[model samples]
Target: MSNEQVVNLNTKNKKINNRQLVKLSIFFTSVIAIMLIFLTNVYIVKEGEYKVVRQFGEVVRIDDQPGLKVKIPFIQSTTTLPKVKMTYDVTEEEINTKDKKRIIIDNYSVWQITDPKLMITNVRSVTGAESKMEEYIYSVVRSELGSLEYKEIVNDEKSSRGSLNEQVTLKVNELLQKNSIGITVLDVRMKRTDLPSENEQAVYTRMISERESKAQEYLSKGDASKNRIIAETDREVTELLAQAKADASVIRAEGEAEAASIYNQSFSKDPNFYSLYRTLESYKKTINDETVIMIPSTSSFAKYLQGNN
Candidate 1:
């Protein structure tokens, strides 16, 4: 080939090579674009995730079932929410009971998003859900506790089964029904109920005073019962002693009367014998081992003592 011809051929070859390179580059770029498109449009709903596909800020698809998922590229976006149960600690808050007693309460709640679409529309996120739930919790607690007396809430004997906690839980669930988030509260628990630091000392002092008053009242009642019992026992003993003395006196009088009648009858039966017996009795009564009985022996008593006619 001549020089001009050879140069022209070289130029043509260069153009062909450049065109091929452009085509190849376009091919590779297209392949990359397709891959990118596929990657962006495709998604996976994991075991514990709820997938939501939104178009122009509106939910179009929800993939709660765990598997591979796909959607239109550049026209829709996906977001995933946790399908597992979640717990949120409600901050400590002070509330006044029906009796106007202030108590500090803190607690937590377990909840799950039953409907992701509703969750998105209402709460929009887990944090939002927690915030909403906290609000509900506070409202329910305030209402429920306010309906109860301070002693009723604090007293173990009243609703020993923690019915107050249950009441709050039920009321919370009911109130949350108005929430479009479709959240079901699995449980509501009380971390603790504490008296405000400012009220603690005063409440404790009042409780102590009440307990001491009850103790003193019981002691006084016991003393009064003891005094009454002692008085009753003393009266019974006095009556028993008097009755025994009266009975003894009656028997003694009856025996003396019987004895006197028997003596009078014996004297009436034998006057001489009675006189002699009386003289003998007098002599015996007047005499002792150390007594001188010379005058008594010389009198009629001597004759009666010798059994003389």
Candidate 2:
């Protein structure tokens, strides 16, 4: 080949090589992009979650099974939602009780998504569902608690709290079901109960007063019982004393009668000796250290003193 032919051939070969390199680069770039699209379009569905696939911002399918899931790239998108139980701490609120008392109630609830499609359609998101749940919870709780007294709600020993919680939970579930909210409340519980800060002191004072009044009432009853017992005892003592005195009087009369009979018999057995003894006994009774007496000499009383009997 001549020099001109050689130069043209070299330039043409170089152009062909450049064209092939451009084609190859384009092919590899397309392959890499395709692979990236396929990988990015795939997702994992966990056991406790639901992967919702939406087309054009609308839900088209839901994958709840635990495995690899795919959606059309750039056309469909997937969002995950928990299928397991979730807890929501409800905001504390103040409510009036049946007894016209106000109390602050803090509550919590356990909930689950029964149908993610329905949930997404109605509530749109977990946060939205929780917000709605909270509304129902507060409403039901308020209504239920409003029918109960403060003591029934707060005092554990006298509480109707279990029934209250059940009523609230049931009512909340009913509302959610009625509205097709796609969630169910398994339980609703009152975490804490307290008097409002402004009312606590007043309630405490009133409680103390009530306890003191009760104590006073018991003391009054005890005093009345004690008095009744004392009165009964006094009556019994008086009766016993009177009976004892009557018995002593009867015995004394019997003794006196027996003594009189004995004295009469003794006098009859020895009339002269008995007369002398009686006279001497009378003399001793009438005489004393300062004794002053006057008697007729002819009288029988003077006869003993004069030794003339």
Most lDDT-accurate candidate: 2
TM-score for each predicted model, relative to the true structure = 0.69, 0.72
Each prediction's RMSD over C-alphas, in Å, is 6.5, 6.1
lDDT of each: 0.86, 0.93
Model 1, residue 61: what's the lDDT? 83
Per-residue lDDT for 96 in model 2?
A: 96
Model 1 C-alpha lDDT per residue in residues 28-130, reported as the tens digit of each score = 9999999999998899889988898999889998898988888988889998888899888999999998889999989898888888888888888888888
**For model 1, what is the alpha-carbon lDDT of residue 47?**
95
State candidate 1's TM-score: 0.69
Off by over 4 Å in 1: 1-49, 53-58, 66-79, 159-161, 246-287, 298-309
